[model samples]
Target chain A: MKTQPLVIAGRTFASRLFTGTGKFSSSALMEEALLASGSELVTVALKRVNVADADDDILRHLGHPQFSLLPNTSGVRTAKEAVFAAQLAREALETNWLKLEIHPDPKYLLPDPVETLRAAEELVKLGFVVLPYVHADPVLCKRLEEAGVAAVMPLGAPIGSNKGLLTREFLEIIIGQSRVPVVVDAGLGAPRTPPPPSKWAPTRCW
Target chain B: MSFRPIFESHPWDDVKASIYAKTGADVERALAAPRRTLDDFRALISPAAAPYLEQMAQLSQQRTRQRFGHTVQLYVPLYLSNECQNICTYCGFSLDNKIARRTLSSVEMLAEAAVLKGWGYEHVLLVTGEANQTVGVDYLEKALRTLRPHFAHLSMEVQPLDQEDYERLIPEGLNTVLVYQETYHQDDYKKHHPKGKKSNFHYRLDTPDRLGRAGIHKMGLGVLIGLEDWRTDCFYAALHLDYLERTYWQTKYSLSFPRLRPAEGMLQPKVEMSDRELVQLICAYRLLSDEVELSLSTRENPTFRDHVVQLGITSLSAGSKTNPGGYAVAPESLEQFEISDERSPAAIAAMLRRQGLEPVWKDWDATLTALAR
Candidate 1:
């Protein structure tokens, strides 16, 4: 039997492999890999793409029927700046679905729980679908849920470290406790290293 | 928090020992990794990576082409003054050095600017010694206002000023600031800068933080290569760059490799960095961060400058004059440091074209800064 489809913010996603639009050598290669993976939801960093240009390479590649864009605020340091960037992205990309990522620390790129919670609450109140990338802190997940975020994305390891499932126990806690969809983001380097199959499996992994 | 804390926390000797301890295997691992870290940078710059020079150069060229395209930005330095209050041991403009001191008048500054414009130069770097009395904030403000209408982009390499002073100059078309730490080794720093405000290492160390706080568009960083162990000083510069990029995400960064050149009454270079080692360092910087602009100045010979252009260097300063009014007004003034590559800007541009790369003269505009304001 086929697995049930994942739904987030009233939208249905058929594929479990949510991909990121970074680290690829070229946009064409990224599009080829993303299309082959059959991912319906993809995340792109707002800072990485030139939103002012209508024919921006990243945006042009993601202009497919199956793909839904998730613009992320990756470079912003504070909640105030994140909110401003989210509004700009919404206007530029014509999408209200945002992946809230506030990593003031650029080296490890660990998410700031305080800024993420603040931005998520503000974004939700602004009538936008908020999906925050955060640490695998169960308490932060509950707080984000209380903030009315559409989804909570927690790291399995440091972003891009390829150290799979370092936070398995914490992921379990977040998955069990999260009321909204829980998307496992960052550090799941390989496709085979997903958490053990359980009733509380994550809605998506990227 | 600022980079000062991170910089102060790391002991110099420990970092040096760790860098010298890197092996060929570590360099190979760093080269093969999909992503690189500061540790990888250390490994890349280590002596172990010397054998892999060809490979590093190839990777650096590829990364540079990918990010900056086949284009080299062109700039010229207009030395505003040779006057100084600081007694820098290696500098020709030291206060104790017996030399003619001169600061260009408004008319003389325009005369120099006019010559640069005639040579099709749009970017100019204003340089002066650490003489706050003669060429302080007020003098700098006047110079910027006078030259703002003449150039597309303006940068300064003067004494480090307060954050408020930097904020004051940005609106006057101050696009970039080049502040070299000279050397990051504290003991060596004190030895080189024994007198005046330049002797205050902490204040100079925190200049980049002030520039960042002032909301500058760009800043260039480096350490004078001959003062101490080149490898360790570069490692500290890379660390500072890492911290700045994170703390000031909006600001762009560039790196320069200024080896000590012979000048009047100059101290002998403590450590001589050979051409091959300098090439390796440049390539390593490119492989570390593909986006950081690498600039080559006229202090390098024509042959070496031509060779390194393709490796990773994104900017080049050609036909440089190191003294005030060296262009046309008064060419007899004592030069800052004798320029090695005396090729004119047009010749350099032709050389870049011969290599199938474009020479960009005006990559920025004042309107963008105006819009930002």
Candidate 2:
């Protein structure tokens, strides 16, 4: 079955199965897993990688031509910190695409809606492709889209929680009315659990 | 609001009475409740819950595996100093003990770090007694700077400081801070900590608030078991945890249960916590909150530690020395407490592997603090 390709920030993605580089026991294992997933777009936490070294353990494994590194501001707590981290990530990874995540709360890693919106607007003005991680709030998703986010990565549940699709109703609402891409991020857990199909297009997950 | 107000509202005697008054019905209700509350926690830890230990253990093991998987994080404690101004009744490092006190120098600190690094320990907890003039913020900052490059995660178990002090240390790559309220009993707290800065019970009670305000990445809180009534003390600890989680929504939290062990010139435990009771407490904590991290140290015997690992423990420290420079620099230095589980890290890791649990050496990275500047 040939699925429709998803386009975000003017870049074409052949695979909608985006992956993340975290919690793997080793970089080699992470590389193998990401490769097996056949994900073209992989998100790497800027806080987890050594950006100064080109051959950093985690970075060295992510050099495949098919992989587009989406450096995320995972540790930043405020809008200013997110902007600073994004700039550093851009210079180090040499890509303007970012997963804007300003989560001050570490327990659940829930995104700060205020900080995400503020950072998204500033990041977009700075000529970066901002994909903000946020809650499954329909109004907040619309607000992020209005603020010029390339896509809104609304969480299915708390990050890393294996409980699947706790926020299905809100996700459906966001997917129904979203103008930009709606990538369901976090809490999808299993590989076989597919993202909900949208009426207009297929929803993405990372 | 700080936890001070909440702590003040819940009188110790009343809470203890309520926990003791819980009936079997309350315990059953708490066990059956889908979402356990603090009240449910009372029933779960009460004497009535003793009969349901097996069921509680099963649920706890399932919940722990569901959340943390079949993995246990490994860490070792590097005792940096035993110098103290406080006269803690249960500690060998108490000022009045008259033992030879030692504080690890920068050279000595790295030597200890080298030994732990050789053991494949990426997480190290630096322990010290409360002595302001010698082992203050300046000394701690230098220690972090010296040891940060060697370890992936660094935690401190030292004297409580103001919020500003934690703010300074966090930028220096300090990941977690463990400040245990020895006991929540006010008069007994004063009795145990008779002298020095630690005698300030309210100040110590509010230390977590300072850490949270300082934007610490993680903070650990617990009450020393066998201090007063273990049940009441732990209830207060849980209440404090609940308040901190709501207030410091940004910071991560961990809980520890340190049963008093034999130490030189130390007083006997006021209340003894049986191994079975401790197991009940661990399982009750898991049922209460699945998100919080639970840790057990080397104070327990190997058999107890091994058995409880399956119950609810998320992290464990093996091959720990509770004295200054006991690792490599000054092995002859006086230890603050006697450790029971003296198994090497490799041996412990092997044991974990045998039990179908993976031993995780490095779960955090130093690069997380790269943007602190």
Candidate 3:
């Protein structure tokens, strides 16, 4: 069985498991893990990079010719902050692709549905390929798709709990109903299962 | 005028046991159900579901792939100030710690913004202590104005402000506010926050209500894991989020699991939430609301964060600075808490790519916050 590529914002990804850079022990370890996983698109929290003098440590290690940087507004909890973070990422990472996240709550760090919807509409209008991090509410997913989001990212669980699919039903509904791509972000666990559906298997934000 | 339901309160231990007593059959039933209800959530979070982690992950991944299609959202935190009045025992900025405190000046805030901008970050989370005079509403407003031009989105993590203050700041480009209840246990809450206005648990509990009333677009919620029973505290947090969502129907909500990371002058965490338990809790929250943003900060170790990328996490914070001007202004100052994963942005991005996830930036705009106003 041949696998298809997962494409977002004009990029193609061969693997289905998308990972984050935040929870690793060291950069070298994270780099090795990413290489081991064989992902094409990687997410780098803009706050961690000193995008200024090309000498920033994080950016330097990501110098692999094959990978593209996806700077995210992970810490910004509102629409305004997301926009500002996106602009910074664009200037530093030199990419127009952005992952919109606005969660006003600090403890749980959940996204603001209203702000995300509002931001999606605005970011798409701003010429950036907007991918929004949102809850598994199917209605909101549709709204985001309508607002022109490149994709909708719903959490499988909290950011690092490794608790798989707490919102399975709604995610199923979203997967069935969504017009854009469905990437399951956050709350993933060990790859203990027989690998995911190959290629166009659909709905995963690793 | 005391109107209340008389349903007997179940022992928290009982509820937790119930949460764990689920069977594989129950898990299958929960998984097979066409439309999930709260009962299904219970089964999914139960121990019986442990054997089905792969199945659950596959479903979660499948759903996520359909909606998000292989992408990951990235972000960073800018510590605005470390001058805390609240005595959070676990924090370096706890009032009683007597550490050297620092709050960013307008200039310092700008310098930090410049650094983040150069870092290719379009989002920013502004952080500070509960000190009002140095990092109060007025100071926040000024800092927002200074930063508005540099970044696309801005959020704050500081003292809880009045609805009017949030209203004012929203217009100035302040977008989100992260307020974590140190713990839900009212008594323990007092013990942890012995001094300062933060001790007023009721007031803090009612903060999201105030934020909702103020008509802010999004708000974040969570509990500090070490101070109380993670289960009960999390249940209450979920209850709070549920209530707030109904009340603030138009607003968006997210949750975080802040396991106690040892700080400069705090006691050891009382209740240790094991990795398995953390996974259960995250799954519980995910089962509760797929829409709610689940965030993992640099506080967590990298291996865990890496493992979870495909499970169920929506947003992540990397290379975070938890001190005032920690980015460029004053690198040596005190931090509210030490960040665990200190990798640079590029290194993190490379890791994400290897996982087959695309990093996203510039997802929102200041214009949207103004629209809410």
Per-candidate TM equals 0.68, 0.88, 0.65
**After superposition, which runs of candidate 1 have C-alpha atoms over 4 Å from their true positions?**
A1-206
> What are the runs in model 3 whose C-alpha is more than 4 Å off?
A1-206, B1-26, B46-48
The DockQ values of the predictions, listed in order, are: 0.04, 0.27, 0.05
Which residue segments of model 2 deviate by more than 4 Å? A10-14, A20-71, A84-97, A122-129, A146-148, A160-163, A189-206, B353-358, B365-367, B370-373
lDDT for residue A15 in candidate 2, whole number 0-100: 83
Interface RMSD of each: 8.4, 4.0, 10.4
Clashing pairs in 1: none
Q: How well is candidate 1 docked (DockQ)?
A: 0.04
Report the interface RMSD that candidate 2 achieves against the true structure, in angstroms. 4.0
Tens digits of lDDT, candidate 2, B1-373: 5898899999999999999999999999998998899999999999999999999999999878767767788999998889999988999999999998888899989889999988988899998889999999999999999999988789999999998898889889898999999899999999999999999999999899999888888899999897799999999999999999998888888999999999999989999999999999999999998878999999999999999999999999999988888889888778888999999999999888778776777666675664443
TM-score for the B chain of model 1: 0.99
Q: Report, for every candidate in turn, its global Cα lDDT versus the true structure.
A: 0.87, 0.88, 0.74
Docking class of 2: acceptable
User: lDDT at A181 for candidate 1?
Assistant: 84
lDDT of each residue in B111-179, candidate 3, tens digit only: 888888777787888887788878888888888888887776788878888878888888898778889
- Number of the top candidate by DockQ? 2
